[model samples]
Target chain A: DQQVKQNSPSLSVQEGRISILNCDYTNSMFDYFLWYKKYPAEGPTFLISISSIKDKNEDGRFTVFLNKSAKHLSLHIVPSQPGDSAVYFCAALVTDSWGKFQFGAGTQVVVTP
Target chain B: NAGVTQTPKFRILKIGQSMTLQCAQDMNHNYMYWYRQDPGMGLKLIYYSVGAGITDKGEVPNGYNVSRSTTEDFPLRLELAAPSQTSVYFCASSSSEAGNTEAFFGQGTRLTVV
Candidate 1:
């Protein structure tokens, strides 16, 4: 069974606009969540993350919000640039699971000029 | 630094064949993991190792095996290739230190079974 789900398969937005990607999880044991950005033929790269203790975490143009009670999280990239067009995956980690990560299907974001 | 390295970026195997996907890391991380990504599906964990000489199965460990003989190497073995095993494999490593939950990944190895 998939513990993490990214219902949206794709998203398109104008450059310099905000791009939002949402994810949900069914396992409440997940205490930490992360976002990874992947380019074609490349491995996923860490983008941003939020601990369950906090509701939001921001780094420059990227922000991650976590709602533990709702078992949901979202990634926001403001002023989306052409380079931001890629597949984004949301992953959840349980504290004692030896760092095993449960990843969502992924959301393909396209930034249009 | 070469954070994580995977060999045979692309390989094609016949059914019933067996091969090993090599992985190495120079970061000296204590935790290493193997994951496979299928078309339109998210990455699924195959196996993981906490340290040298220690290994454990993950969500999708069937038809696969792994060995962690040293901190720098974690190799995945496909005992019998199958059509369903055709996918992109990724090797990742991360430090177990507190406040460092992110994992560094290799470029990935694409394997096709026919």
Candidate 2:
């Protein structure tokens, strides 16, 4: 079973616009979420994260919003830059499982100039 | 900074053969992990260690063994390789004190079994 899921396989946005990536989780035990950006031939790099206690968390141009009632979370990049293009993965914390992580299939975000 | 180094960047093994993948991190993070990723699927944890001499199984721990003798190194051993084990393996480390923080991943080691 896929506890964490990013239904969208890919997304494309024009530079200077906003890019939104969404994720959902089936396990209610997950109380924290994280976003990672990956490029070809390199390991994934952490972007932003949010906790169940907070509805939103922001870091520079990146922001993460969570809705417990909907079991969903999203990452938004305002005034997206072409350099932001990469595969974005959403992950959830499985605390009961020794802090093991459950990741979504990931969405390829394309920020076109 | 050589955050996480995984040796033998690429390897090929025959079915039933055995091998070991080495991973070392300089960050001195308390948490280390091993994960595998396949096409169309996200990352799956194989094993992890909270500190030296302590290890735990992850979501996909079958057919694999791990040893953590020191905080800087965590090696994964494949006793008997299988075709299903052919995939990219990654090693990561994190400092949980940083609010259940982010993990730094290795460049990844691609393994193929015939």
Candidate 3:
């Protein structure tokens, strides 16, 4: 069974707009949530992460919001740029689980200029 | 710095063939993992090691094996290649120390089993 899920398989956004990608997880034990961006034929790179203790975390143009009560998390990109076009994956992990991450089906984001 | 390195960016194998996927990291991370990504599916963990000589199976361990002989190297072995084992394989490493939660991944190896 897939513990993490990204309901949207793909999203298209205009440049300079806000892009939101959402994820839901069934496991309540997960306390660390992260987002990764992947370009074609490349490995996924870490974008941002949020700890369960905090509701939101931000870095530059990217922000991750976690709603532990709802078992949902969302990643937002402000002023989305064409360079941000890639597949974004949501992952969660329990700190004690040997750092094994449970990944969600990635959401492909296309930023149109 | 080479965060993580995987050998043979691509490979093709006939049925019943066996091969080892090589992975190395220079970050000295104690945790290493092998994961497979299928078309339109999320990455599923195959095996992982917390330190040298300590390996454990993850969600998907069938037809796969792994060994961690050193902090920098983790190799995955496929005993008998099957069509179902065809997928993109990724090797990642992370430190279990406090405040280091992110994992560094290699470019990945695309494997095709005939």
Alpha-carbon local distance difference test for all models: 0.96, 0.91, 0.96
TM-score of chain A of 3: 0.99
Candidate 1, residues B1-114, lDDT tens digits: the string is 788999989999999999999999999899999999998899999999999999999989999999999999999999889999999999999998888899999999999999
Write one digit per residue (lDDT tens) for candidate 1, span A1-113.
99999999999999999999999999999999999999999999999999899999999999999988899999999989999999999999996788999999999999999
Q: For candidate 2, lDDT tens digit of each residue in B1-114?
A: 889999889999999999999999998887999999887789999999999999999889999999999999999999889999999999999875747567889988999999
What DockQ was computed for model 2? 0.67
- Candidate 2 per-residue lDDT, tens place, A1-113, comes to 89999999899999999999999999999988999998876788899988899999999999999999999999999989999999999999955455677899899999888
Clashing pairs in 3: none
Cα distance off (Å), candidate 3, residue B1: 0.5
Off by over 4 Å in 1: none
Candidate 2: pairs in clash: none
Give the TM-score (vs. native) of candidate 3.
0.99
**Alpha-carbon TM-score of each model against the true structure:** 0.99, 0.94, 0.99
DockQ of each: 0.85, 0.67, 0.90
| Cα distance off (Å), candidate 3, residue A85 | 0.6
* Number of the predicted model whose DockQ against the real structure is largest: 3
Worst 10 residues of 1 chain A by lDDT: A94-103
